[model samples]
Target: MSVMQGDGRLKSQRFRQAREGDWKRLERLMDKAEKGSARRLSDEEILAIPVLYRSTLSALSVARETSLDRALIGYLETLCARAYFFVYGSRSTLMGKLGAFFRRDWPMAVRALWRETFASGLLMLGGAIAAAVLVGQEPDWFYAFVPAEMASGRDPAASTETLRATLAGEDTSAGLSAFATFLFTHNARIAILAFALGFALCIPTGLLVLYNGATLGAFVTLFASRGLGVEVGGWLLIHGVTELFAVILAGAGGLRIGWAIAFPGDRDRLDAAADAGRTAATVIAGVVVMLFVAGLLEGFGRQLIESTPIRYAVAGTSALIWGLYFYGPRRRPAHV
Candidate 1:
């Protein structure tokens, strides 16, 4: 045992002696950079930062594998961390970061979770289709699918004239602000809930999305029953495209985290969850903006535009713009 200990000590000492030059070089560079700024670094030193960081990381790994002395391991770990921050961490201004987030970080994050987003969207669609068909077959099913408070007195038994009046914004113009506020708060709440519940393995997220879709489906059936389906479709789509898409993105965020929690692959569960949270959080940020857009359309525009064609046109335009924003050609962050 004493011989083994001696050999270990000798090896660690030899290792340090061989690599001390690089370690001191890194230390000097870090000190110099911190004294002024990374921007002050010469081009050659700036280029060396990543190379040195990677080499230090490699050294750390080897030290751990070889079971080097804990003190040496600790020093290497600290050096590697500092190097990582200097090389990869952002030192940009807040505006610069925000610009990059919208330009690249968000879109890349969204693209990373396309599978989860697709699944979330399909769940909502299934619920919508199911509720639409069931409620159309039995009008009372509307009551079951849509809560009375949200119904706002428009039920299956209401006369066609009453329903048509609502769609034409005749009696509903005064309620536009309240309507927009309500939808904004409601969708925002659902999106947040979906993301928060993702730690529960996404079951709650899926169910919440499905319930939202079903409510819409039932609402559509009521309009169809009165032969006002086309009118109601226009009213809903004016903002529904953005609102619904926002909700789905929220669900995708939650699901991404939940999946990471449930199946962390080779990474640590906590680490995996953290990684997923970063990406998911980015999507959620964009979801808030989308909900704001939806709210504006629902509250203000919906009240002014009573023409079915105009309503459809507005909805189409919003959808097209959103499509281009999320799925458009890529661009490197200008200032990132």
Candidate 2:
């Protein structure tokens, strides 16, 4: 047994000695790559990486088979893993990544979620219709749908003049900047919740989305009943189009995750959910940007431009721009 052990040690030492130079070279290259110095590597060094990686991989396999020193095996394993990522992982800079996200990733993810987006919109519409009918029948339903804090005395109890004043930007007690900040924070919270709770089979996400629509409907019904339908329409649409669109997209993202978990088709449930998450994450990131723009419109444009016609024009232009950006046709990339 002692003689056999001695033979094994001798073989292991010879094996490591033969391949140690290649391993050290690969390690040096990996250090440069990891430190973001890959761009500075010589052309020959870049070409040598793969060759060294393959050699190290082969060494690892041999070490495992021959039962070489455990420490040597671990080192090779770590080196190979690092090399694999450097070779196959994303190499784009920060700006390049941002450009890719806006130009391709975000839009493509939104396109993929079309079915979910439609479903979410329909849910919101249904809730709105229901709330509108209830509020129209009895003003008390407005209290249930639109919280007091959100309504801020703009309910059925308020006079027509008061509501009209609010829409026409005549009510100036609340600073525009503060209002904008509040609106952004509120919308962002709802959007994030809708996405975060989607993993529970989409029930919570759907309900949250429905509730948001109900709030919108309740407010609209209150204003419309007071004979300020056209005025309120302009006021809301100025920022509502973008804000509501963002919420809908957020709901769609959550739905994607829920649907994947519930019905993974042939794939594993976890795997399907992961795939959906990647697409949903991309969409949610874009939704945040949309919400920011909506807040700006609500804060400045809605307050500065009190004319109903101009408000509608601004709303229409925003709608057109968003529609084109998300659903526009694109030329295919040329094959290399």
The top-ranked prediction according to lDDT is: 2
TM-score of each: 0.72, 0.79
Where does the lowest 10-residue lDDT sum fall in candidate 2? 167-176
- How big is the positional error of residue 210 in model 1, measured in Å on the Cα after superposition? 0.9
List, in order, the clash count of every candidate structure: 0, 0
Give the number of the best model, judged by TM-score. Answer: 2
Expressed as tens digits, the lDDT of each residue in 1-336 for candidate 2 is 999989989998899899899999999999998898999999999999999999999999999998988988999999999999887888888999999899989999999999999999998998999999999999999999998899988988888888888886635635878988998999999999999899999999999999999999989999999888899999999999999999999999999999999999999999999999999999999999999999989987898889999999999999999999999898776789
Displacement of residue 294 (Cα, Å) in model 1 is: 0.6
What lDDT does each candidate get? 0.89, 0.93
Clashing pairs in 2: none
Candidate 1, residue 310: lDDT: 95
Runs with alpha carbons beyond 4 Å of true place in candidate 1: 1-90, 170-175, 332-336
